[model samples]
Target: MGQQVLYETPQISIRYDDYAEWLHVEWIGDQDYESVVSGATKMLEYLEQQGCRKVLNDNTLVTSMWADAAEWGGKEWFPAMRAAGCEYFAWVYSSNVYSRLSTDLTIQYTAAGIVILTFDDINIARLWLQQM
Candidate 1:
C-alpha cells in the first residue's frame, strides 16, 4: 500500500495509507515531552479523521528518548487512540539503548486489548500491520 503525507513537522511526519487503513508516523531528531505529545496527538487526530485502526510508528531516527513522554503516552494517548479506532500498533525499535529502554517502558502501558508489536526491521513492522 502507498501513503500520503497528512501532516509534517521538523520532528515528525504523519502519513496515511488508505488501503491499509493505517497511519504511518516517522519520527526524526530528538523530541522533548511537549513535542512528543503534540506530534502523537496530531497523528491520532489524523488517524481518527481517516477512520483507521492501525499505526506504524517508525522511531528509529529519534536521537534521544523523551522518557517523560512515556507516562503521558501511556496515561493519555494510548487510550485516546484506542478509542479513536486504533486496534493495532507497530513500532520500529530505536537503535539507541537508552531509547529502547524508554520504549520498553511505554510498551508496558499501551493498554490492554490493543495489539502492540515492536520490530527491529521496518519491513517486518509494515508486513505485520498490513495483515490487519
Candidate 2:
C-alpha cells in the first residue's frame, strides 16, 4: 500500500503505487471534465517519476457516472496519456458497457495497448501487464 499522491480534489484522489505499475484513482462524486483530466495528468507525471512506461488503471473504487462529462473527460485524458509515454493501459471494471467502450476506444485510438477485465478475475489483467 505504498501510495503517493499525484493530485487531490474534493471529489477525487489520484495516486501511484510502487508494487504495481498502476495509477489508482478514487472518485467520490460528480466532477468537472477539467478536474478529471488534470488529475489524470498528475497521475501520468507520477508514473513517469516512477519510471513506469505503462499503467494499470485500477478503477475498482470509482463510483461516478461514466456518461456525458466523464466520457468527454476520458477522451481528452486518454490521448494525452498515450502521448505522455504510457505504452500500455488496462482497467478492471464492474460494468459491462464501460468495459466494452473502454476496450473499444483503446483499440480504435491505437495509442497504447489497452485491456479491460471483468471483476471476477484479475489474473488475466496481470498477465497482460507482464507481456507489455
Candidate 3:
C-alpha cells in the first residue's frame, strides 16, 4: 500500500497508509521509557488524524530494552488508542533479545480490547495488518 510520512525522528518514523487504512510505526535504535512514550504519543496523534484502526508497530531496529515503558504502553497508551478507534495491532519484534523481552512484557499487561499479534518478520506483520 502507498504510505505518507506523518512523523519521523532518529528514533522513530510514523507513516500513514491510506490505501490499507493503517498506521505504520517503525521504532529505531535504542529506546528508553522517554523515547517510547514520545514515539507512541506521536503515533497516536497521527492515528487519530488519519482515522486508522490498525497499527503496524515495527521494532526491528530497536537495540535496547525499554521494559520500563511496557506497563505504560499496555495500560495507558493501548487503551487510549482503543478509545481513539484502533482495533487491530500487528507488532514486529526486535531481533535483539532484550528488546524482544520488553515487547513481550508489554503484551502481558495489555487488555483484551483490541486484537494484537506479534511477529518476528515485518512482512508477516504487514500481511496480518492488511488482513485485519
Task: Tell me the TM-score of each prediction against the true structure.
Answer: 0.94, 0.60, 0.97
**Candidate 1 Cα misplacement greater than 4 A, ranges:** none
Count of backbone clashes, every candidate in sequence: 0, 0, 0
List pairs with backbone clashes in candidate 2. Answer: none
Worst 10 residues of 3 by lDDT: 123-132
How does candidate 1 score on lDDT?
A: 0.87
lDDT tens digits by residue: candidate 3, 1-132: 689999999999999887988999999999999999999999889889988899999999999999999999999999999999999999999999999999999989999498999999888888878887
For model 2, where is the 10-residue window of minimal lDDT? Answer: 111-120
Which number leads on lDDT?
3
Residue 117 of model 3, lDDT score: 92
Ranking by TM-score: 3, 1, 2
Residues 55-106, model 2: lDDT tens digits: 6655454444444444443456566666666666665663445533543454
Model 1 lDDT per residue over 8-55, tens place: 989999999877878999999887899988998898899879998899
